[model samples]
Target chain A: MQLDVVVGFFLLGMVAQLLKAPIKMPKGLYESLTLFLLIAIGLKGGVALNSHASGDLLIQAAAIIGFGLVLPLIAFPILYKMGGLSRIDSASVAAHYGSVSVATFAVAMTVVEANGIEYEPYFPLFVALLEVPAIAVGLWLARDRNQELDLKKAAHEIFLNQGVLLLVGGLLIGWWAGARTDSLMPFFSSLFHGVLALFLLEMGRIASSQLGVLRNFGSFIASFGVLMPLVGAGLGALLAHALELSTGGVILLATLGSSASYIAVPAAMVVALPKANQSLSITASLAITFPFNVLVGIPLYSVLVGHWS
Target chain B: MKKRAFAFEMAVSFVLMALGLVLVQLGLPGYGLVVVAAILMGLSFVTRKWVAQTANVKVAAPKRGNH
Candidate 1:
C-alpha cells in the first residue's frame, strides 16, 4: 500500500514532466500550496492533541532536532568523499544532507498520521529549524570574507529566503492558531489532506522532470545519493535505539535522518557559493536522492523504526 | 546601489510571503508559494542578466569615448 502511494506520485510527476505542458505554476502558488498543506497538517495534529500535552511529544521533537543536526554531520563526509566533488561542491551537497525538506517531511508526517500513528505536532518546527544550520555549515566551508558582497548575500539568503521565512513563519502561526481552536480550526483543519496530495503531485512533476538528469550525474554522485540516505537511516536508527524512542518516533527520526535538503541548500548555494557546480548539486538532490527517499528510504526507515519500537 | 540591491531582494521575498498567505487565505489549491518562489527566482536570474548588460554598456560607453 505504501509502495503504491510512493510509486503513484512518482508516475504522476513523471507523466506531468513528459507532457511538458508549459503550464508553469507561479512561485507564490506553489509555496502557498505547500504552506497550506503544512499548516493544515499542523492544525489537524493540534486538533488531534486538543490541548493535551504529553511527555513523549517533547522527546520526539528533540529526536527530530537531534537527528536533524547529527545526520548531516555524518552524511556529508561520506557524500563528499564518495562523490569526489570539490570542497565547495561537497560542502554544498553535505549541507543539504543535514537540512530537512519540510515538504517531504510533511508528506511523511501525513503518511504516519493516516496510518493512525502518533507523532509530534511540534515536528514541523524542527523541520524549519534544521534547514538553516547546515546552510551555515555549508557557508562556513566556503567562507571567504574577502568577498563582502557574497557574505552579505549569504546572510540574506539564509534568513530571508521566501521559503525559509514562510515555513518558519507559518509554523509559528500554525502553533499560535492551533492553540486557538475555536476560531482557527475551520480554515486550517479540513484542508490538510487535499493540500498535501496536491503538493505531492507538484513534487511528482518536479521529480519526473529531473529523472532525465539522473544518468547525467556521474556514478559516484548518483550512487552516493542513494546510498547516503540508507547510511543516514541506519545512524538515525542507532540514535533512536540509544534514545529509546517510540516506534513511531524512531521511524520519524530515521525518515528525518535519511531525507536531504533539495530546497534550502540549493537556494543557499546559489547565493553563497555561486561558482560551485549547481548542476551537480541540484541534479543529485532532484534526480537521484528525492526519488530514492520517497521510494526506498521511507520503507527502509519504517522497518528500522518498527524494530526499534 | 548595494543597499538597494539588498532592499530589492528583501522586497521580493516579502511580496512572495504575502502572496503565499493571501492565496491560502483565499482557499486556492496547489502549493502556490513554492512555485511562486521558483518563478521569482528564475525571474531574478533574468533580471541579473539585465544588470550585467547595463553594467557592460556603462563600461563600454566610457571606454569608447576615452579611446
Candidate 2:
C-alpha cells in the first residue's frame, strides 16, 4: 500500500511550517474541503447502507456507541490521577480522545482502500455515531466543576454541529437517492485524494504551529497523547475480536477508538467546559495525537487488526 | 452596515450553491459533490450569522460596561 502520497503532503505541510514558509490555504477553502470530505464520506456510507441488513446495522451502531462511551471513562482516571492533570484538563482531554477525528479516519480509509481491504460500507455512519456519546460522557465526567451544565444546550451543540449535521444529512440523502447517487462519484470519489492532500497540508501546518505549545504541557501530557491511542486501540481490538469484525472493520474501529477529536469535541468543550484549557485539549489532540495516528497509529492499528482477526 | 455585510455573505453563499449545481448539471460522476457544494453554501450562511451575532456582542459589551 503506497501511503506516501498522502503522508508526503502532510510532511510537506509540516516542513513548510517548520521552515516558516508563507504557504497558507484560504480559511474558507479549508473549511469547504472539510465540508466536502464529511458529506462525501457520509453519502458513501448511506449509499452502502441501503443494501446492508437492518439487524447488522443496528448491532454495529450499538457496539460503536458503547465503544465511544467507554473511551473517555478509560482516559479520565488516567489523566486525572496518573497524569495528575486538573479535573477540567483531564475531562477536556478525555473528551477529545473519546470523540473521533474525521481526518485520521479519512487516512485510515485511504489506507484500507490502498490495500484493497474490504470494510463495512456503513463505517461512515459509525463515524457519525461515534462523535456524540463520548462528548456526552466527557461532559458528564466534568459535571462536578461545571455545575450549570445544560443538557439541552449540549445536545443542541453535539447533534446540530456542522460536522455531525453534514455527515448525517449526507447519509440520509445518499440512502434516499440510492443508486441514483452514482452520478456524484466524479465529484465525491474521484477528487477525494487531491482534496485530502490539500486538507492534510493545512493540518500539517496547524499541527506544526501547535508544537511550540506542547512543551508547556510537559512530558506527561505529551506521552498521554501517544499512550491513550494505544490503550484505545487495545480495547478496540478486543471489541473487534468479540464482535467478529472484518480486518477493515477492525482497523476502522481501532482508528475511531484511537483517534481524538480536534474539531467537534473542541468546539463542544469551548461551550460545555468553559473553564477547561482549550490549548491543552487542542494541542493533545491535533498537535500530538493526530499526527501520531496518521503517521504511525493507522499502520500500527492495521497490524493489530491483522493479528486480532 | 451590518445588514449590508450579511447580504453580501448570503450572495456569496448563493453563488457557491449555483456553482455546485453547475457541477452536477455537467454530469459529474459524483452527484454527491452537489451535496458537498450545498454544504459549503450552507456553511457560508451559518458562518455569516455567527459572525454577525459575535459582532453584535462585541458592539454591545462596551455599552453595557458604561452603565
Candidate 3:
C-alpha cells in the first residue's frame, strides 16, 4: 500500500510550521471542510444502503457497536494502570481511541479507491454506528454509578454531536431520497479528496502544535498512542474475517479500528467530563495516534490482512 | 549507574516484539498487543530506580554574576 499523495499536504503543513513559514488555514474554512467531509461520507453510506440494507447488516451493526464498546474497555486499564493517568483522564483517552477519526477514514478510502479495491458501500452506516458506543462506555467508566448522569445532556452529546448528526442525517437523506440524491454526487463525492487534503493540512498544523505540550506524558502516552491502534486494528481484522468481509472490507474495518477520534469525543467530553484534562487525551489522539495511523497504521493494517486471513 | 534498570526496559520491549509474533500465531493479534501493553507497564516501574538515581545526582550550581 503506497502512501497516498494527499498525505504530502500534511507533511507540507508540518514542514512549513517547522520552518516558521507564514501559513494559516482559516477557522471558517477548517470548519467548512470538516462539515463537507462529514456530510459526504454520510451521504455516500446512505446512498449505498438504499440498495444493500438487509438482515445481515443488523448483525454487522451489532458487531460494530460491540467493537466500539470493547476498544475503550481495553484502553482504560492500560492508561490508568500502565500510563498512570487519573481515572477521568484515562476514561477520556479511552473514549477518544475507541471512537473513529473521519480524516483518517477519508485517507484510507482515497487509497482504496486509487487502488480500485471494492468495498461495501454501506460502510459509512457502520461509521455512524461506531461513533457513540465508546463515548457512552467511557462516561460510564469515569462517573460513579451512584451519581446521576444528566441523561438529556449525554443524549445530546452522543446522538446530536456534529459528527453523528451530520453522518446519520446525511445517511438518512440519501437513503430516503435514493435516486434523487444522485445530483449531490458532484459536490459530496467529487470534491471529497480535495477538501480532505485541506482538512489534513490544518490537522498537520494542529498536530505540530501539540508537540511542545507532549513532554508531560511523552514516552508512556506516546508508546500507548502508537501501540494501542495496532492492537485495535489487529482485533478488527479478526472480527471482519469472522464476518467474512471482502478484502477491501477487511482493510476498511481495520482502518476504522485503528483510527481515533479528535473531533466528536472532545466536543462531548468537554461537556460530559469537565474536570478531565482534555489536553492529555487530545494530544495523544491528535498529535500522536492520528498521525501514526494515517502514515503507518493504515498501511500496516493492509499488510496484516493477508496474514490474519 | 544502574545499567540493570535500562537493560530491563530494553529487554521488555524486545520480549514484547517476540510475544506479539507468538500471539499472532494464535490469531489473537489484538490481545497479543494488549498483553504486550500490560507488560510494557512493568518497564515504567522498573525504571523508577533510574529516575531516583538521576534525581539524586548533584548538579553544579551556576556562578552568580551581573544580572
Candidate 4:
C-alpha cells in the first residue's frame, strides 16, 4: 500500500514525461507544494521536540551536520582524482550530494507514514541545518586565492535561501505553538499524502526530462550517482545506531543522508562557484540521485534500519 | 534600494506568520500554510535581487565595451 501510492505517483510522472504529455504543474505551484511540505514537516518536528531529551537531540543534530560536512569531502576526492573531473566540477557535484533534497525527504516521510512507522519529528531541523555546511565545504574545496570570493553574497544566499528559511521558520512556529496549533493538524497532517502525490508527480516529470542527458554524462558519473547514496545510507545507519535512534528515525536519517540537493545548493553554487559545470551537477542531483533515492534508497534504508534495530 | 527590498520582504513574512497564526487559532491545518507564507516572502526577496542583478548586468555591459 505504501509503495503503491508513493512510487505510483512517481512512475506516473515519469510516464507522463516519457509520453510527451502536455500535463504540467503551474509555474509556482511546485514551489508552493515544496514550501507546504517543508513547513508541515518542520511544524510536526517542533511539536515533538519537547518530548526528546535535549542532549540526544543536540548529539543527533551535531552528527547529522557532521554527516553533511563529511559527505562532500568524501565526494570531492573521488570526483577529482577518480572521475577525472576538475576541481570546480568536483566541488560542485560534491556539494550537491552533501546537501539534502526536500522532495526526496518528503517522499521518505510519505512512505514512513503510510507504513505507520514513527520517526523523529525534528528531521526538518536537520534538513535546514544540512543545507548550509555542504555549500561552504563545496566552495572551500573549489577556492582559489586568486579569485575574488563574494563572501557577503554567498552568506546571504545560503542563510536566506527560501528552503532554509521556510523549514527553520516553520520549526520555530510549530515549536512555539505546539498543541496550541493542533487545529492545523487537519491541514498539515491529513492532507500531507495528497500534496506529496502531486509533488512527486511533478518530480517524475522533471526527472524524466533529464533522461536524454544520462548517456552524455557517461557511465562513471551515472554509476556514482546510484552508488554514493548507498554509501551515505550506510554511514547514516551507523550514525543512527550510535545515536540509538528508533527504526523510523534511522530510516529518516538514512533517507536524509542518501538524498541529494537539487534546489538550494545549485542556486548558491551559481553565485559562489560560477565556473562549475552547472549541467553536470544539476543532472547528477536531479536526474540521477533524486530518482534513485525515491525509488530505491528509501525502501533499502528502511530495510537496513529494520535489520539494524 | 536593497534595504527597501529587504524591508518589504520582512513585512511580507510577518504578514504570512500572522495569517498562519490565525489559521492555527481557527483549528485549521495551518502550520504548513505558515511555512508557505515564509517561502513566498523569501521568494519576493529573491526576485527583487534577481531583477536588480539583471539591471546591473545590462548597465555594466555597455561600460565593459570601453575596456
| TM-score against truth, every candidate | 0.70, 0.80, 0.85, 0.79
What overall lDDT goes with each candidate model?
A: 0.63, 0.80, 0.81, 0.79
TM-scores for chain A over all candidates: 0.83, 0.96, 0.97, 0.95
Highest DockQ scorer: 3
State the lDDT of candidate 1 residue by residue for A1-309, as single tens digits.
Answer: 255354465557657788985446667777788667655544554444445447766775566566656655665665555444577777778778778666667656656766677664555555666678778777666556665446688889887776677666665555555556657666766666666666667777887777555444434455456556666767766776677655666677667667787776788779888878887777777766776667656654554355436
Candidate 4 lDDT for residue B55:
80
Fnat of every candidate, listed in order: 0.00, 0.00, 0.03, 0.00
Chain A agreement with the truth for model 3, given as TM-score = 0.97
Per-residue CA lDDT of candidate 2, range A1-309, in tens?
Answer: 234479788989999999999896776998999999999899999899887748866887898899999999999987887666788888989989999999999999998988888888888988999899988998888888528787788788888888889989999998889899999989999999999999999999999999877546644465567667877877887787677778898888888889999888887888888889999999989987888777767875675466446
What are the runs in model 3 whose C-alpha is more than 4 Å off? A145-148, A306-309, B1-67
The interface root mean square deviation of candidate 1 comes to 17.0
Give the winner by DockQ: 3 or 4.
3
Fraction of true interface contacts that also occur in model 3: 0.03
Candidate 4 regions exceeding 4 Å error are A1-4, B1-67
Candidate 4 Cα lDDT to native: 0.79
What is the C-alpha lDDT profile of model 4 across A177-223, one tens digit per residue? 87887899899998988898998899899889986675455434655
TM-score of chain A of 4: 0.95
DockQ of 4: 0.01
Q: Residues B1-67, candidate 3: write the lDDT tens digits.
A: 2244334334545655666666567664444344444545554554454555655663322323322
How well does chain B match by TM-score in each candidate? 0.49, 0.58, 0.44, 0.66
